[model samples]
Target: MADVAAKERRILVAVDEGDESMHALSWCLSNLISENSKDALLLLYVKPPRAVYSTLDGTGYLFSSDIMAAMDRHGYDVAESVLEKAKRMCKDLHDVKVESIIEDGDPRDVICQMTQRLGVDVLVMGSRGYGLIKRAFLGSVSNHCAQNVKCPVLIVKKPKSTVANN
Candidate 1:
């Protein structure tokens, strides 16, 4: 059989601190991406807008210096940990290229933009599998990306058993 993936496929998987996103990454590793010479997997982690807005924006209120510093530290720590864990997961898959991308913005928008910019063959991500009410209240990143991205979107939902354990 011909090695179809050798044609240079770029698969982008959006990940975060959530277990669901990690599961999606794992799924992509084991199912979609393979040890094809020209294929690449891009793991993207988007840090949402900070809890506190800058005083430069003209807002009279300002977050305390200590609190703001803590927020910065936490964001960096989480990003590094997640990316490292993701990289470790893919280390054994020889011949499959892996890249980590960390961005700061609304994930829904960032994921869509990066997907097109990277010319991704497919955007793989996880769905929180929220009910209609929950999704309506919080919105769904995977759902939004599926609608907006130019590339195909693959949303891997958490298994029922896994969800139950959490």
Candidate 2:
């Protein structure tokens, strides 16, 4: 019974293009996970769906091939870059397992859905560190997930020292 409780945990970390998310990944690896823990880390990146605009004719502005193509290209590039960085961070951890996950939709909804679907033991992410007014107006993803998910949620905030340097 003691061994089972100490067994590796299924940790899911939601990441994005921001440095905050990357920092959370590092925090998770160094703190929650260990060389001996054998924990599995799933790095999730949620991309917003492509823009769809309608004109007076009721046809999608997506008919603008050039504009649509550029938007799609940019989105794909960002998703790839962020996921790559997260994967690179885990390259040195020989004992830990890492999986890259990309989902398309509203980040708050997708993240919550995936957490429950994957049966994650803990959901870890970085807080935007927004002040009260900002979070209230913007409706924070971290806040929403914390309230909805069954698993424990860890919100890593970048330290003041690092913020000062940046």
* Number of the top-ranking candidate, with lDDT as the measure: 2
- Candidate 2 wrongly placed segments (more than 4 Å): 1-6, 51-63, 129-138, 163-166
Please report, as a residue range, the 10-residue window in candidate 1 with the lowest summed lDDT.
Answer: 51-60
lDDT of 2 by residue, 6-90 (tens): 5677899998877788888888878877666677889998876553112222455536788677767777788889889889988
The ten-residue window of minimal lDDT in model 2 covers: 49-58
Native-to-model Cα distance after best TM-score fit, residue 164 in candidate 1, in Å:
11
lDDT of each: 0.76, 0.77
How much does each candidate deviate from the true structure in C-alpha RMSD? 4.7, 4.9
TM-score of each: 0.82, 0.81
Tens-digit lDDT track for model 1 on 1-166? 9776666788898877777777888888778766665678898988765632243234525667886778778887888898888888888777778899999876788999999999999999889622344344437878798899988889998886775221
Best by TM-score: 1
- lDDT score, candidate 2: 0.77
Error of 2 at 57 (Å): 21
